[model samples]
Target chain A: MLPDSAPLSAATATSPAEEVLTVEHVSKSFGDNHVLQDFSLTLHRGENLVVLGKSGSGKSVLIKCIIGLLPVDAGRITVLGQEVGALGHDELDQLRTKVGFLFQSNALYDSMTVRENLLFPLRRHWMADRRGQEESMVMQALDDVGLVETIDKMPAELSGGQRKRIALARTLIIPPEIILYDEPTTGLDPITAREISQLIREVQQKYTTSSIIISHDMNCVRLTADRVALLVEGRCYAEGTFQELQQLDDPIVREFFV
Target chain B: MNSTILAETGAITNFAWRFFRHGFRPRYEVQELLYQCYVVGYQSLPLVGITGFIMGIVLTLQSRPTMAQFGAESWIPTMVGLTIVREMGPIITALIFAGKIGSSIGAELGSMRVTEQIDAMEVAGTNPFKYLVVTRVLATTLMLPILTLLADAIALYAAYIGINLKGVTTLALFTNNIISTLTFGDVVPAVIKTFFFGFAVGIIGCYKGYNANKGTEGVGRAANSAVVVSSLVIFLLDLLAVQITSALGLN
Candidate 1:
């Protein structure tokens, strides 16, 4: 495992040698059921790390704890060098502005049109731009996801695949330094899933941002992950690159990708 | 016979208690409240307005014949005004509000959660409770009173039209009679009760929608629960308010 505070150099794409996130010895439990036990991982400035696990293996729970969605019963999660739990409300909102999350369901606000969906974040953060730079920024994000033509359409009008793509566009509209993707391609057809995988790769290549992708799909783990972690028995059972994991003889590792 | 009603009452009480625990906590959502207001208040105004007008006219017309037997037809305006301000206005307006706002909130939030939008907000570093529940509750609290007042006004106007349908009372006399009969006690108590009605409806909607589980079935349950609970709360609060006002010699 990478050291929690290990400094970044070549992988530091956003700034001059910065470690994006450091999570150390995190443990979470729901009463008697332990979801995450002593889980730890460090995300570099610009790399994409995919987490793979079987169903009910605490993959989503680990990321949720890191993002402060599910309060960690134990351990530490630090993002951009600030402790996640110790931050107050304003601080948490500030930190959140820096991070973008793509939910498993796309989570596009159904009340809004695609244009409005893209504007939700912009409207919330409009205080930052005195000059109003969002006209070009929104168009650019939508263009990146190949959704420039569907700006006026509501989410209910869009197909499942289109919704995921629009969600991806919204994620980039924030220009976040770190992205947490929760099952980015779970319910899509193989072609759409592959397209989503390609979009993930494109996002990684285009943005000088780091990401933690939570997916059970091995093809995604194989295609986009620079490193992979298997969450089993409420802990990181194994951590390595896809190739290294594939080569392992252990039943847990073999069973995950097989 | 009592068992079924007792069971239903118990279920509602338990649900209200859960909502209290979740809603009272800091970082609870208020976004759904705004959406609810938009749906329950703004979108529903036209329907309630029309209904209130017709209700007033019909009530005035129906009452005139009965009062005419005692040559008390001149009391029509006072009677209509009292009915609108005291009872018909509040109950009908609330039920209409329940049908529109309560159901929409329940269905929308239930669907959002089932679709995982609530979870997405949490991951995106936004508090779902603040974003979803708080706005809707606050909006309802603010809007419901305004809606009820509007409904009461329209209903009174309709009652005037109803009075004119059968016999003639000059608008001035009609106006004077309505004004003289309307006490601050009647108006204030009725208005005060509306705020509770809105709060109950908003809170019940948020509670049902937020805690919804089970998928498509959950959405139905949420909507069903919201309407049922909000309607009950409206009547219960009305009963309590009437008692308090009577005790204080305001009735």
Candidate 2:
């Protein structure tokens, strides 16, 4: 197990070269219930960091805080060099365009069709040079998820796996510098979950985008994680390469593997 | 109980403040506002129309015997017309609007909140408040007044039909009698109050829905409370409007 004070660096042969996100001694609480206490972790450029934790262990809270949906009670979060809490609404919005977040629920808009849903973020960010190319961009995003045929369908019409893929496609459409996956494989079947995990890996390679994936799904962690950080009681207890973490003798870490 | 009410009032007021802060800024959601207008105004027509017609007919028929007993049957059109335009049209339409649109906005936003769709919108670089709340509130505020006017017209027409159902009063005479009784004071105050009614319904619905919690159950609560609160607010606003109009010697 790595020291808690040190940054969670990958022990793999091809090491992470740059830092894209840093969570330093972050603590968040809802009233007296401290969900995270002095939690610290860093996401490297072009590497997948899976935060492994049990249910309701502040995994989702961490993701929300990073995205500025929830404010941290203490400490700082730096995303692509800008302090998360310090950014204004418009500035945060500008930063958000560079970072993609995939919610566990997929969070596809029920009122809009897939095409409109894909166009929502694209148009909202309003990349002036790409105005007329919206159709092609949407098609490309759909093709990435292999759901181009379901482009016109509402979110309610898609299957669970399809919805997850479409949600991923929506994130990928903008080609963000970093992608945060909050339990990407939480509710899917084993095969679908594996497919999603593989897709996560493929996205990392294709875009060379850094990612922080929150998951208790071991298979997903095994498939997608270049490095793994074990969150225990609102702290980064230990972190290492997935294989290195597996070889560790710590019982708290072993509990996750078993 | 008082503290809870105070807390809720404070929160709603804060929500309103946020609405004003973001509502008038550039990058206006004109398309969403128009769509919401169509939904809030056009789609609500059939129900509001039927209610107005029935109200007009019922008021006319119910008052006929009383008017006959007082030898004032000739004054029925004037009486019904003044009542519909000055009170019943606005209050009844606002109530119906609160029941339908208020509940809808609450449920929709609550569901979106629970499912993280709202956060997704934020992450997509779109202010969900601007896109959802402001558009909806603006739609209700602008559309409610128009809907009230339409309801008043429909009810007056129905009252005319109710008059013709028994007596053979010509359409021209009936209209003239009703129009002659309606002053600017009667029309303007009632029309002005409908805007407040609409704003109340829209803001309350958006507030409940936008702040909803506890998953699906929270959504249910949001929708339920939105209708209840907005309905209550409609009556309160109507009372306040009456007081204001009376104070202005428009009564």
* Per-residue lDDT of candidate 2, residues B170-233 (tens digit): 8899999988889999999999999999999999999999999999999999999999999998
Q: Judged by DockQ cut-offs, is candidate 1 incorrect, acceptable, medium or high?
A: acceptable
Instruction: Name the best candidate (by DockQ).
Output: 2
Write down the C-alpha DockQ for each prediction. 0.42, 0.84
Model 2 alpha-carbon miss at residue A1, Å: 17
Give the CA lDDT, 0 to 100, for residue A235 in model 1: 65
| Model 2 spans with C-alpha error above 4 angstroms | A1-16
Poorest 10 consecutive residues by lDDT, candidate 2 chain A: A1-10
| TM-score of B-chain for each predicted structure, in order | 0.87, 0.98
